[model samples]
Target chain A: MQSSYFTGVTTSNGVMQHDFTVGEVTGALWSSKRAECAPLVLMGHGGGNHKKSPAMLGRAQRLVVDGGFHVACIDAPGHGDRPRTAHDEQEIAALREALETGEPVGPIVVRYNAHLAERAVPEWRAALDFLQGVEWVGDEDPVGYFGLNMGTAIGVPLTAVEPRIKAAVFGLHWPEALAEYARQITVPIEYTLQWDDEHIPRESGLALFDAFASEEKTLHANSGGHKELPRFESDSAVRFFVRQLVRPSIPQPDLVW
Target chain B: MQSSYFTGVTTSNGVMQHDFTVGEVTGALWSSKRAECAPLVLMGHGGGNHKKSPAMLGRAQRLVVDGGFHVACIDAPGHGDRPRTAHDEQEIAALREALETGEPVGPIVVRYNAHLAERAVPEWRAALDFLQGVEWVGDEDPVGYFGLNMGTAIGVPLTAVEPRIKAAVFGLHWPEALAEYARQITVPIEYTLQWDDEHIPRESGLALFDAFASEEKTLHANSGGHKELPRFESDSAVRFFVRQLVRPSIPQPDLVW
Candidate 1:
């Protein structure tokens, strides 16, 4: 199994944040300072966003502090501290131009994010391998994935092949390159879609949600544009993780001790 | 300006239940014992269910105890304590035969429920008028309506004509006769749909959700058959009402006292 190299650790508001690296991947882990062991949740940051973006930190805080689970987020390729390649620069420029010119950014975003997913999926698997090896972040129970927008672009493929991830919260992406992967995912899913998304068509969001093969999937379609995804959804996702991870049938030896 | 005739009152588990009548319409109200006045939520029970069915009582318990709101439910015409007419009996027989013979019950249920809605809508208005007149159940803020199946049938039209309802939680019914009324309703809405419902087609549910003219609406589609709606949705609805009714801007004068 690949090993993660720990760099720094900090505690704030009762949550312990650990900075770690797996090969070239840069990530941060947040956990309750008091819990002995908890299920792990891997979150993928959006395009142009870092692992510790406010959205990621906020969700991680809830997962760690409220859910009593270890949460980790890795910066997507060409984002955050990672140096962007010439290809990344070119695609980003095109996307910016499309947005500035009032042209549809869907094609460019779908094409670019799909490329990033190809690279990030392996990094996520390796990170999980290293995270589960830690005594405090045991692999006895299944892990979960929560991501949206560009995060959803990468998470769909990651959750598809990652057997360790038993549940996921994913949405706000088109099905173009992701629906096939979504169909392969059979774990419980909580998906969010904006009813009046300016970029992604409503049908596209619904279609992607429909592609998921999970027997226990939920689609939460709110009446707003993409970025206006309500804050309450974050709380709902945390509760979902609690229900899926803290099952009464499973004996949590780690939690007991 | 009608007055409610109180028939009985009981308290259990920190909740107060009031049995009342407006003219011939019988109903029950639930509220927290300590709170002087809170927002009111009117619930419509499912077909073949009474005002205080298990679903109604359980939801009322949460709304009253957890949400700090008064909840009321009335017996639809020819339901609960009311006597069923010959027409009601014939329709009931048709629905029962369809269910027992493994035949489609949608047509019969839709036709019968629509008939009930016509009678139930005015009764609900009278109940609301009477309930609002009570000292403890103030009408300062807009009320909420929650119902599914037959409840949705009654609620769609009731909400259309009753401008006092600012929010509603509706689902588990076809659009058929309800879509026109749904379009007239511009209040915030939370709708639920079973992905694999046998009676209602997926498109039918989606279409009904689409018909709502509410600018702020949500569709929660879960992967389950018609009778398998997850219990957590009830909690979600309670939170939604809290967001709508207990707003920061709306000075809750009733709650202050």
Candidate 2:
């Protein structure tokens, strides 16, 4: 195992910004005592949270420890040291106003939010580009993605536009638009739902699943509620991603504590 | 196709508290629907939500409409029209306190909340008894469960304690204690996770998945964040549950829109 490295770097996305890279690669060997890179998995956190979110970090750790995948996580726009755009507060106020007026917020508002939430994808792509340009990491290393809530909301759409992502695992959020996006994705994908998740009704989950065009799809249900992370099937996620991204010829090492 | 029926009754501690019966039953013809008897699926909702939560309702709809299974759903304590109990408030306070303290909270808290949430499961059981007493429902119908966030927390532990539930689908939440509980579960199960769920971190998901004892398990990652629901996958969940609960000899009808 190689020692993990953490560095803060500035990247341009039509604007200059700082983001953190949390792993290291050495001469065709990707290693981070904390993570491994067969297919580097980039993670995005939800709205109002950062890459340090307990949930996000938990997933990051899982991808690193169990899946043997290196993770590149970043805070999205209006999140984690990033400045909010002029429309950010305005959009939030509009949502609040819509809620107060009891006016049915239309899909346009949702679309707008989704668009804003994904503003960082360009930056993420740049970061991935920089990673790919690294001398130590292999040039053809596959890339995977994992995003939560708003992260999923933005990431799913990004997946349609960015084809480098080889596989993905999306958690909690599953919207109708995902159907359109799922049709565009060629990578193996996994989607999970929280049965009693009051925040985003289960119908949304059903709709997203119905949208996926992949035959490699799988689903797991645990006996827990929406607020908790799914315990019964998380490791399977690691296994699935590793199996798809890592070279199959390499024997999986027996996991030891 | 059989006509669907809806009725409300009360129960206590796995027994009926009332004798209200509104459907007809023959040797194998059960209740208001003419569909063949299949396993009974019990569904529960989360706090401030009812059995009709879009997610919960959609799941039940899938079970009934697509899976060709019978579903019984009820609002838990302090939820829906059910009266709140002191224990409910206490549990909520405890959860908040735990979160505030940064202490590790697991499925046990969710299970404890479930006990408090549906202090009236007994009443629901009574209703189940009434349904079972009907000629068509059959006394030996297999039983399964599906619950969302809070509903899952409650249902998982209840299913663990009650030997009747043969299988289950737990959405959103994955608790740490699940590894130990997985050992106790003798039925087929599935769990869902949002890779980028903002509400719950992925680490918690890993802790929960590590607990599962089921050998026959699968995980799916859809492209969405936490707040959104996975409506597209509802059919996949229904398909899984149907395979687990419904016998192949019974001709299942196509899903109705």
Candidate 3:
């Protein structure tokens, strides 16, 4: 990962955001200055959002300061700063026309997903490969993973491939729909869902959670649309990462040390 | 259709929403007093929401008053007042449990959609069959159809088999996925799609529109969630239906009778 002495304010947790080029992907890195070597959490944002998006940045700040872990976020392919595909243009045009005239826009959306599916996982893996070699980053094991909707799509496969991602937070996948990839996920997972989601059908989101083979997993769901995750759920996620990375207090032996 | 001196406050447009049972289906009929013999438009609501839902009611009021068409709406099978299926119970339980515990709810969701696919069309046909025998509700030709989301699921097949429906306003279908039914719709169609819709993948929705055989079709796509359609789009539907149903006033020639 090529990190730059970039211009940006240090966050409350002493997390500094810097522009980065990991492998062929361009992204932002948020790392804490206080810790020379810290537990790291890699975040993937939802579809149509970028690494520095408010949600991504907020989580990065929390994890770095509160959880004592460096956090990294990258835009999904054709999203953020990445170049858009030809299909994306056609799809957007079709979509605009549909909105103007009230026609079906399903084909474009489905195609857009398909296009992203082909590249999302591969790109995430590349980002992971770069992070694994970083000195100040916890390159070894127990690195946490945080992804929502689109993040879930890319992160699920990443978890399956990378052994370092010890804990994860994500949801909104149809395990059955993408059986080959969804079934292979076995890391400790925390999946969030919206019960009354307009697009992500409630049942499908739940079903994706069941597809994970992890023995240690939990579902954090609330009542709302795709964007309306309750405030408390973020606390749940923070607690999860802290619990996962910060070893719990060990009972001192009665025999004494 | 069962006509009754229904007890309810009629809207400013004289649109009356009356409860009725068409064969085995229970639904509401929204008609205007000023245009009892005017063009009739049958309406269908999206998933989760029921007939006479605010969205449905508002549209009904608009069409009856501004466009001069009596509108009717019915709950899809296993929706609204219709009895919930056994599968719905399991799906709901699974969803609630999944939300609480982070389990997979995909299978149940997939099963639910499949179950509806089987019954949705047949029930819609039953409603249409009952409507065909009504004296006021045009048993002959030039009838109009309007549906969205689940409405599309039931209405698509209804449009295919019912020859009287001259035009339609609906969408949220994957034609290739449901080729048999989707391919059969030949009437002029106006399909609405939400660009950022989570549940209905954009491509599949577009593909569904493509599956129709209609030569005259328009796509009205918008940027928002599933429920967040722009206000002006309703005016677009009103225009389409009015253009289809209301004949243009002819210029009086000197020699004309």
Chain B TM-score of predicted candidate 3 relative to the true chain B: 0.81
Q: Give me the displacement of residue A255 in model 3, in angstroms.
A: 23
TM-scores of the candidates in the order shown: 0.94, 0.45, 0.46
Clashes of 1: 0
Query: Which stretches of candidate 3 lie above 4 Å from their native place?
Result: A1-13, A93-111, A248-257, B1-257
Instruction: Kindly indicate the candidate among 1 and 2 with the higher DockQ.
Output: 1
lDDT string, candidate 1, A1-257, tens digits: 45568899999889999999888888899988875777888898778889988888888888887788899988888898788999999999999999899999999999999999999999888888888877788778679999998889999999999888889999899999999999999999999999999999988998999999999999999998878887778888999998887673555222100
Model 1, span B46-72: residue lDDT tens: 999898888888899888877889999
DockQ leaderboard ranking: 1, 2, 3
- Give the CA lDDT, 0 to 100, for residue A221 in model 2: 37
CAPRI-style docking class of model 1 based on DockQ? acceptable
Q: How many clashes show up in model 3?
A: 40
Cα-based lDDT at residue B113, candidate 3: 52
Candidate 3 local lDDT, B216-248, one digit each (tens): 565555545666665545656777787677752
| lDDT: the better of candidates 1 and 2 | 1
